[model samples]
Target: MNADRARGAGAVRSPSTATFLSFLWPGLGQWYLGRNRLALVYGLPVVAVALAALWQLNGGLADLAIQLFAPSFSLTVLVLIVLLGVWRLISMADAFTAAPLRTKSSRRPTTLFAVLALLAVIGHAAAGFYAWSFYQAGSKMFVAGLGGDFNSVAPGASGSGTSGDLVAKPGATPATADSRINILLTGVDSSVGRNHALNDTIIVASVDPKSRHVVMLSFPRDIAGFPLWNGGTFSGKINSLMTYAGLHKDQFPDGPLPSLIKELGYLLGVPIHYYAAVDLDGFRTLIDKVGGIDINNPRAIDDPDYGGWTDGRPLGFSLSAGVHHLDGQSALAYARSRKGNGDNDFTRARRQQQLLVALARKLTDPSMLTRLPDLLAAASQTVRTNFPADRLSEMLSLSRQVKDDAIQKYVLGPPYALRSTDATTYSLKLDLAKLSALSIKLFGADSRYAANAPASPSKSP
Candidate 1:
């Protein structure tokens, strides 16, 4: 054979050794072959991409991985995933096929490859288990925490019937073109120094499955005299329903929350499919976990009882007009504050709805990955809901499909509900006709009270 042909066909190092080494570190095999320049070429880009991801995710590569599932950033995530896959493949191929000048490798290729393969399999299995456990933990926490006083009934209510008995009749359908799902989101402060956690924040999120449209309807806490289930009226402020049910227990057999759910359905003329109650105290932890939230403060807010540290002033918390980034405490104060201009129970209700939307946007951000564990922990402790675990995938899918601009917001105060003084105290006297019209327009039909709904509202709420 010719000298050139002999050189080309010379003996090389173990292909298995090179493949294992490259698998360990993208270019380690090339470096072992004394191909420093080639190693840099194969490794640097991968390292750079990894570093960039870490920086953007606030040192959380796992968060970036999770974010890949989010619809908004799927394209970018797909590209990065493809690039990484191609790089790994190229590195492995180059390492395995590279001609080695030496007769043998220092380490036993078979043993080394076996060890690496075993470790990889074990690590992958452990990771899968951990992810599943984490999801289960979060799911259980959410379900248990959000479920309202399950056995409690409000005063004057008879604990005779269960919620299953009161809900829309089986197989009942919507009155409009699309089906709508309404979820009641309640926020309460039942922490230290508070006598009872009255649900100060009451919101009904109406989701249209077909159009992917959403309408958030805020209910003021002061609305009273709404008829309750099991006969009699829900006395006192509307927000006090949960507390009353909890205290009575006898009146609300299915729980105090179900009473409010039924009442809300009656008031709005819409079927409330599910309910979630979150303790406001954990609001700060949740906000901090997502690296805080941004809100456009149209006017200055100054509250004396805003809870802890007010920049050396007796006033507990103060946020100036304009856009502000709020940590958990500040955000909580902003949402809880009823001292600013346009800041009443009504306005506070609207702010609470706005805060939810803002927080949702913040949680979807990539930087939220590192804090996701903490956020879920806080939620597990703070949130209580009747939303079933089986419907989680559906919720995620609906959330992804819902567009921002398609959302319609309504505060059941002011023009729709006039603040008035009843015989005992103040309450929002709702214009039932107007309110029903608005609900139909924003929520798009109701299966429960199809005949009661009026014409659409002249303008958006």
Candidate 2:
């Protein structure tokens, strides 16, 4: 239209109804003010997101982590509704009172940019909300097998887990006492290595949720003549037992792990109900993820003759006395190092116990609560578990059961452990009968390691 026609269009009265309309529905006011471009600026994304939300509401994510993505998606739309309302009200007021709409569209790019910018901003919020919800959903929904809330395993009860272990309040008591839950925590030295290759570390960890008692006992790596998965006996490191199970799957049928579990169960006289296995590398990563640990040892130690790593790496670790902090990789080195005279495999076991204790102290600190998202994010990505996804809260709450001072550590060597003087190739002495008695006491039918008593564990069976 010509300038004269544009001028004669109207007296250009202020759009009293425009802001109200925008306030009512955003794009509606823009459309009423004769700005098709402005109306669509708010209209398109609003329509797109509304459609997306409707589509998602139909149950597309039942088996996967659906809730993780949904809530955040809703929040994004909410933000858009607010922002578009503000922009449409301001722009439509300009179109109403200023003129019959500018004949020239020189400002079109700026308007276009504003609309696109709003979309870009809202889209970012949507992505962030989705990511955060993903982890929150994961931490809430994910469950490691032994984590309490194993209720599904049992018919009526919630099952004996951390959730069931909660002590009655000061005046109230639980409906019933919790039953015991047993787990076999095993570490096999099976990676590519020399010396005592394959099956290296083995332990039985038992928990009595009702009594809040716990037991942990380590089996000597070189406990000769221990029963094997096959219908025979083997004469090497106990750690080798796991390797045998892994390598000779056919001979030991129930997989190699079952035989090892069976023998430990036999010793403890309790059925093993759960299992957790982590490689040497994963142990280090986990420690690092938790922001390291602190261990106090007065004596300075130095021994470089570690055999696990090919180059000059620490199967052996040396430390200048006093308390020190460790990230995951360093912690792993400390736990696995067998160097100084006081730092043999026995010392390594003690170190592992120490590391665990330090980790317990800070795991649930207020500082850690913030870090939980990042730490758990890393964990869910790298770790694998048979744990149900819905019981994570129960496990996190139950983690409080273990205290720094209450953790127990044990070793088998020297006086308590008898190494055959005749057998001279790095073999620990095995005391099957005494060891069994001790095993019964530690992880037995009752204690869940929730005790305040601290004990050092040892064995050569």
Question: Which candidate should be chosen as best, given lDDT against the real structure?
Answer: 1
Please report how far candidate 1 places residue 170 from its true position, in Å. Answer: 12
Model 2: CA > 4 A from native? 1-177, 187-200, 228-231, 307-316, 369-382, 412-417, 421-424, 443-461
Candidate 2 per-residue C-alpha lDDT over 1-461 given as tens digits, one digit per residue, 9 for 90 to 100: 74434434555422445544544455655666556666677667667766876774553333123244233433454465456445554554454443333445322334443454465447555555545655554543233333232112111212222211111111012123364555555443434544433544565555556545555656656667654323466666666665565466565443344455555555444556555444455456566777887788656667677544434454566778798887676666666777666666666666665665566565545466445555655544333333333333334445567554444556655544677665768676566566555654564423222132235433212
Scored by TM-score, the top model is 1
Residue 124 Cα positional deviation in candidate 1, in Å, after optimal superposition? 4.2
Query: How much RMSD separates candidate 1 from the native structure?
Result: 9.2
TM-scores for the candidates: 0.68, 0.58
How far residue 93's Cα lies from its native spot in candidate 1, in Å, is 23
Model 1 misplaced stretches (Cα beyond 4 Å) = 1-133, 142-162, 167-178, 308-314, 388-394, 453-461
* lDDT at position 331, candidate 1: 81
